[model samples]
Target chain A: EPEVTQTPSHQVTQMGQEVILRCVPISNHLYFYWYRQILGQKVEFLVSFYNNEISEKSEIFDDQFSVERPDGSNFTLKIRSTKLEDSAMYFCASSPPTDTDTQYFGPGTRLTVL
Target chain B: AQKVTQAQTEISVVEKEDVTLDCVYETRDTTYYLFWYKQPPSGELVFLIRRNSFDEQNEISGRYSWNFQKSTSSFNFTITASQVVDSAVYFCALMDYGQNFVFGPGTRLSVLP
Candidate 1:
């Protein structure tokens, strides 16, 4: 079965440095999303992207965060400046054409900022 | 606001035992979707099942079954005769028509031999 895949399974970055997490969503899916889970915390939604635009975002997705679908298959999340609290697992998910379609998740990228 | 609750933080069962994971949700939208995902120690979140608000039917597949109760706003999952392979962290999630998705704190299951 086809699955969502992410690059840089684990990353370590210095505080105040920029970081980019990349994902290749399942081909043929139309909607994409980014979510984060702090260690020992619930998964929290960050932003959703469709049609090359942001569909929705959470308060946690503030000025530092941005998502891009630079190519057909590549979706990426960039943090302009990392903070210590940014250490967490970031997941990328994609859904089919329908709004109610089931969302498929990727393995996740563990981001560690020090 | 949409929220999902998985009250049980962790559960341990011997192999061949049956175990149930509870999920409750809060949503104001009349139409919504509920889902379950399993994450093994490997850290990949695998989709298990999805149930819509309109469907109250109980579904069974292999040793896994799901109970969807609109009245209680709950969607619970059960594994029968579970094996060690069933050990994983399971999460319940809710999404409204507006595309707001929320996930509960996962329940970690450990099936020992």
Candidate 2:
């Protein structure tokens, strides 16, 4: 089955450095999302992207966070000046239609900030 | 704001036994969607079922069953004659058209062989 895929399975960055987490959503899907899960915590929604624009975002997705669909296949989440709390597993998900309400998720990228 | 709660942190059941994972959601929207997902050791979330707020149907697929109750705001899942391979962490999710989603803390189930 076709599924969402993410690059840089694991990343380590300095506290003040920048990091970009990339995802290639399932082709033909219209909606894409980025979610994060702190170690042993619930998965938290960060932002959703559709039609090259952000649909909705949580307060946790503050000024430091940005998402881009620079190409037809790539969806990226960039964190400027990573904080220690940014250490978590970031997941990329996509859904074909909102009617079915099924979003397929990718193998998450583990981001570690030191 | 919407929230999903999975009260049971961990459940232990023997292989060939039946188990249930409970999920309760809080949403103000009359129209929303509830979902069940499984995350095993592979660390990938697997989609299981999706139930809208309007549909209260109880569905069954092989050894897996889901009960969606809008009245109580609960969507529960049951596994029958579970095998050792069924051990994993199960998560329940809720979402709407806007793309924001809420996920429960998850239930860790262990099927002892």
Best by TM-score: 2
What is the docking quality class of candidate 1? Answer: medium
User: What is the iRMSD of the candidate numbered 2?
Assistant: 1.9
Clashing pairs in 2: none
Off by over 4 Å in 2: A97-100, B96-100
lDDT of 1 by residue, B15-100 (tens): 99999999999999999988898988887777788888888999898999999988899999999999999999999998888878
TM-score of chain B of each: 0.98, 0.95
Best by lDDT: 1
TM-score of chain A of 1: 0.97
Worst 10 residues of 2 chain B by lDDT: B94-103
What is the lDDT for B2 in model 2? 85
TM-score of 1: 0.92
Task: Give the C-alpha miss distance for residue A9 in model 2, angstroms.
Answer: 0.5
